[model samples]
Target: MSNPQEPYQPVQPAAWPAEPAGQPGNPGQHGAPPLPGNPPHGAPGQYGAPGQYSSDGPFGLPGQEPPVRNRRKPWTILGVVVGVLLLAAVGVLILVNVVNGATNHARGLADGFTKLVIAGDSSKAYDDYLDPALHEQLTKEEFIAGIKTLKMDRTCKPAYNQVNASTENGTKAADVAGLITCDGDKKIDLAYRFEGTDELRMINIKLKPQA
Candidate 1:
C-alpha cells in the first residue's frame, strides 16, 4: 500500500533455479569451467569410439570426414588386365609363325631332296635329306635302288594334299603326303615324315602308283 503511493515502484523478477551439482548439462558451481577431459555444456561430443575406423566410410555422423579411398587401385587392375591380353596376343602370334615356318621348311626340304633323287644324284640326296638314324637302316645305294624300283626318279612336280607338323616332348615332327606326276602321265602317291624343325631331315618315305 505504501509503495503504490510512492512513485509506483516496479517489482524485480525472480532468479533462475541453479542446476544441481555434478549434472552433465551445466558448468560447475558459480559458472566455473567443466573438468578436464569433459565436454562443454550441451555439446554432442565425439561420435565414434577412439581408434575405431571404417573402410566403408563417409562416416554417417554430421561434420565428420570419411577415409581417403585408394585412387590407384582401379588403375592398377586395369594395367594388369591389359598386360595379360597383350601377352596372350604375342603368344598366339608366335605360335602361328612357328607353325607356318615349320610347314615352309618341310616343303623346301622335300622339294630339294625329290629333285636331287629324280636327277639321279643319289650321293647328294642321301647325305643331305636322310636322317642319321635312317642311314643305319638302309645304305645310300639301297635307297636309290628302291627309288628306281618305284620309278619315282621319273617324277615331276608334286601336289601335296596334306602337310602337317607338331611338337611333342620338345621334338618337332612333320608329315607330307601328295601325288606326283610322272613323265608318262602316270601318277604316284608319295608320303614322307620329316623330323627336326630348323633344318629338316627326312626320316621315312613311301611311294605307290594310283590304284
Candidate 2:
C-alpha cells in the first residue's frame, strides 16, 4: 500500500526446465506416459512385473501371445474317410441291383419269343417280337419257313440261361444268349439281340446246333 505510488511493477511466474513429465506445452496431455503393457497413470489394477504382461483377455491384452489350440484329431479324419467309403459302396450296390433287374426282364422277353417259334407258333412270335424291319424284308410265311429250316418248328421248350442289358442310341437294349433244349434232347446254342424303345423287338438272331 505504501509503494502504490512508487510504481505499478508486477512480479513474473518462474519458468520450468523441460515442462516436467507431461503437461500443457503439449496438446491434450496430462501426466507421464506409462510403461509397455500397462495403462496410463490413475487407471485401475496393479502394475505388472518387469517384461511381463497380462494375458486375461482374447489374443492377450497387447504384448502377450494368443492361446494354444490343438489340431484335428486322428479319429476325426478317419470318420470322414469311412463316411465317403460307405456312400460309394451303397451306390455300387444300387447299380448292381438295377442291372440285374433289367437283365431278368430281357430274359423273360427272350423266353417268350423263342418258345413260341419252337412250339410251332411261328406267326405269333414273328408278329409280336420281330421288328418291322424284319417284317419288311420277309413275309410271315417266310419267317415260319426260316424257323422250319432250323428244324425248330416243332413242339419244344426253351431254356434261356443268360441275358445282359445295355444302352444303345440313348435307349435300353439287351442280348440273350443261351442253350435252347428242344424235344428229343436237341440243343441249339443261340443268341438274340434286341434293341430299345417303348416295345421289345428282335434286332438280330444267331443259332448253332450241338449234335
Candidate 3:
C-alpha cells in the first residue's frame, strides 16, 4: 500500500465565492440596494444629497399637504358681537342726550310764557307763543280779558317745580308745573302744555288754587 503514513498534505480551503457587488463582505462595494426612483450614491436626485432621505415624504415616498384650518371663524364671530354692542351703547347715549335737551328746552319756554303773563302781556303771549290751534279757539282779546282779574306780582320771579316730556301721537310734547308768587305773597299752581320740537308752542295753560 502506498506508504500508509506518508507526509501529511494540508488541503487549501476553497476561496469563498467572490462576494457579490454591494454585499456586506465587499469593503470597496456599496452593499445596500438603490432606493426605487432614487439616484445612486454621490449624485443628486430629487433631493440635495445622495443616500439622504427627504423629510417631505414618509419612508422616501411622496408627501401630501396638510389640511387647511379655518383659523378666523372664532375671531370673526367675536368681532361681530363687539361691533353690535358698541352700536347699541352709542344709540342709548344719543337717546339720553336728546331727551335731556328736549326737557331743558321745554323748561325755558315755560319760564318765558309765565314771565309774559305776569307782565300782563297776554296779547304778545297769544300771538308769539300760543299754538295756532289754541289761538283759533280763544281770541287774543278774550285771552287778555281772562287774565285781567288775576292779581299777579310783576316783581316776584316764577319758580318751576317739575318738567316732563313725552311722545304724543308722533309729536314731541311736554308738561311743566310750577308756582307763581303773586301780590300779598299769594301762590298759584300753574301748569303749561307745549308741543313740537323745533318750534315749541304753548298749547294750553291752567291756573289752580294751591292746596
Candidate 4:
C-alpha cells in the first residue's frame, strides 16, 4: 500500500492569453494608426507608413506679395518748358529789329532833305517833294521864279544844323532846321519839312534872318 499523502507531483504551467488577430504586439502601447508605405516589421508586402511629398505636403504655411515703386518724368516736362521760352525770346528779338530799322530810316530821310535844301539847288530840292498842283500849273521857268522869291542868304554859306524826327504807324516825318549866311551880311534860320522814304522829299521851307 502507497502513502496517499505522498509528495505533490510537479505542477504544469498555465497557458498565456492568445495575442489578438489584427493587433500587433508592441504597437498597442503607442495607440498610433499605421501609415501606408513603411514596412510593419520587415516583410516586403506588409503594411508601411505613409510617405512625404518631396519631404513635406503641399499645404504648408502663410506668406505675402511684393511692393511697387515710383518712376521719373521731370526731364520730359523740363524740355517742353525750355522750348517755349526759347521761342518767345526769338519773337521778341524780331520785333525789336523791326522797330529799330524803321526809326533809322526816318532819321536818314530828314538828313537828306536838309542837305538838299542847304545846297541852294532849289530846283532839285523842289522836285524832290513834287506837288501835283504846282507841277501842273507852273511852267519850269515859273518854278525857278517861285523859288527865287525866298531870298536865301548864300554868302557865309548855308548848312543844315539839326533834325528832329517822329513817326506814326508806317508814316514818318521830320523837322529840319539850319543856318544860312547871306553874302557875309547876316545869319538866317531856315526850317523845312521832311517826308520819309529812300527818296526823302522836302516841303514847307521857312527862312527868317536874325536881327
- Which candidate ranks first by lDDT, i.e. highest? 3
Worst 10-residue lDDT window, candidate 1: 48-57
Over all chains combined, what TM-score does candidate 1 have? 0.60
Global fold similarity of model 4 (TM-score): 0.39
Candidate 1 per-residue lDDT over residues 37-71, each given as its tens digit: 87864345444455554343345654355657999
For each candidate, what TM-score against the reference? 0.60, 0.60, 0.62, 0.39
What does candidate 4 score in Cα RMSD to the true structure? 15.9
Task: Give the per-residue lDDT of model 2 (tens digit) for 1-211.
Answer: 5545666688988876777543556444655455578776434343345465455423546535556666567778999999999999999999999899888889988988888878778899988888888788878898788788779745555676778898767788999988877677788888998886777688787767876
Each candidate's number of clashing pairs is: 0, 0, 2, 8
Best by TM-score: 3
Which runs in model 2 stand beyond 4 Å of their true positions? 1-73, 150-155
Error of 1 at 205 (Å): 1.0
Give Cα-based local distance difference scores for all models.
Answer: 0.78, 0.77, 0.80, 0.59
Clashes of 1: 0
Residue-wise C-alpha lDDT for candidate 3, range 46-140, written one tens digit per residue: 54453555455454354333446898999999999999999999999999998999889889998888888888887888888899989888898
Q: What lDDT score goes with residue 5 in model 4?
A: 89
lDDT of 1 at 52: 50
Clashing pairs in 4: 35-49, 36-48, 36-50, 37-48, 37-49, 38-48, 38-49, 155-183
